[model samples]
Every structure is written in C-alpha cells, then in structure tokens.
Target: MRELLVLLLLLPGPAVAEEAPPAERRTELLYLLRQDCGSCHGMTLAGGLGPALLPEALSDRTVEGLAEVIRAGIPGTPMPPWGFEITGEEARWLARKLKEGIPP
Candidate 1:
C-alpha cells in the first residue's frame, strides 16, 4: 500500500490551469502593455515598428505561441524579452486579451 501510494504520487496528474492575475496586477499588466509594448506596437495597438496586436492580426496565431513570443521575444529584432517582468501565466493572459481585442 505504501509503495502503491508512492507510485501514484510520482505519476503525472491532470494539468492544472493557471488562474488569472489579481485585479491590481491585471491593471498593472495592461498599463505595461500600453506603455512598453505600445512604444513599438502602437498606442492603439494598430501597428507601428512592431506589427499590430489587434484581434484580427492575432486570429491565426495560437495563444501559447503568442505567449511564448511575449516571454521570449523575437531575437535579432527590436523586440526585447519580457520574461523578467512577467510570468508565463501572465503572458498567456496578455495573449488572450490581445486575441479578444482590448477595450478602448
């Protein structure tokens, strides 16, 4: 019974979904998006030095893919990695928000 329980504990379980960031953190993230990302993606997120971040522009991309880009950034480009400032879960949330189209 002890061995069986140990085996069960060692086995992989179902994937756990990450919870959304708290309201205050979400607000701060949004502000970072507007200020930092906006510097390249455009204040309206339409387009600028970087491509547009609007929903339509992101429609073909997967949330995970976008999140990876957000976390890792494109190398050899002006884009800089943001992994230091945000967690992977937060990156996913931002990716989802971009896909949904942020409200004006």
Candidate 2:
C-alpha cells in the first residue's frame, strides 16, 4: 500500500512539471513583439518602418492572418522572413498571444 501511494505521488510530479511554462509563452511573445519585431515595426509596436501592430491597428487582421504573415513574411519591405527562424506553430502561438493581448 505504501509503495503504491509513493508511485501515485511520483507519477503526478512529472505530469505537473510537463505542463507548458506560461513564462515561456510570454517571453517568446514579447521577444517577437519587441526585439525581433522592433527592427521594423518600432520598439513599442506603435509603428515605424513597418506598419503598426497594436490592437487598434491590427483589428482588421485575425490571429491566423498574423501567423501566415509571420510564416510567409511580407514582400517588398524591410521585414524579412521569419518562417525559417521560427516554426509555423510557434508563429501561430505568438500571433494568438499578441492578438489575445499582453501587458506592456
């Protein structure tokens, strides 16, 4: 009985730890929104060499559209392709996080 109890407790530890880290999601989103994007979109994402991506400006675009842009890259502009650097899934995650909203 004690061995079974110990096994049950041990099983949950790995299961709980396997959960994705919220910090990772936030960090990746911030990096994409700020650093990686700042090169053209401006430091605050308000607007710069690239078009603004703030909620107000991006209201017309859906998360999927944003993912496609990230995956395919905008043509005829300074924004280079990121599909090679980050996977489509990662891009989708970033798009969802950004569109869903995040703290400044």
Candidate 3:
C-alpha cells in the first residue's frame, strides 16, 4: 500500500516533465545536444570549428553514422566524445531529429 502510494506520487513528475510531443521532445533534446555538443561542432551545426552536419551534406550517411558522430565526435577536432553524456538511444533520437530538420 505504501509502495503504491509512492509510485503514484512519483509518476506525475515524470509524466508532466514529458509534456512535449515526441518530435518536440526530440527537437529540444537535439537543441540541447547541439548546444552542449555543438559548443565545439559549431552552434549552427554548420562546421565552424568542427565538421558540418548539414542534412544535404550527410544525406548519404546512415543514421548509424550520425549516431556515431553524436556518440563520438570527430577526432583531431575540438569536438570531444559524448558517449557518456547521453546513451546510444538518446544519440539516435537526436540523429532522427536532425534528419527531420528543425520544424517551423
């Protein structure tokens, strides 16, 4: 009974925090990932101090390739790996959002 009460109380926080739509959530995550990860990869993902991430530029690459980039940034560049900042799943999610392009 006590355990059930705790679970009930805790569920709302997680649920409320997930208010964004799946795509929106992914977009926000991508923005954050870009900001955190892009600190080195260029704020616009256009390869400033780092490599570019333009969709047309990466159109030929597989999502896995993109995920790898997110997981482990390009070597010999200012970009450092982010394998630990977020999980593979999160990386993939970001990749999908990038592929979709930031919605209007």
Q: How close is every model to the real structure, measured as TM-score?
A: 0.81, 0.68, 0.62
Clashing pairs in 2: none
Evaluate residue 31 in candidate 1 and report its C-alpha lDDT on the 0 to 100 scale.
Answer: 80
lDDT, candidates in the order shown:
0.82, 0.64, 0.61
lDDT of 2 by residue, 1-104 (tens): 33433343344332244322354553555565677787687776777988877777777788778989988887987777788866766776666555644434
Q: Poorest 10 consecutive residues of model 2 by lDDT?
A: 12-21
**Model 2 per-residue lDDT at 60:** 77
Model 1 residue runs over 4 Å out of place are: 1-18
Off by over 4 Å in 3: 1-28
Top candidate (TM-score): 1
Candidate 1 per-residue lDDT, tens place, 1-104, comes to 33433443344433224466765677778888888999999998998999999999999999899999999999999989999998998999889878977754
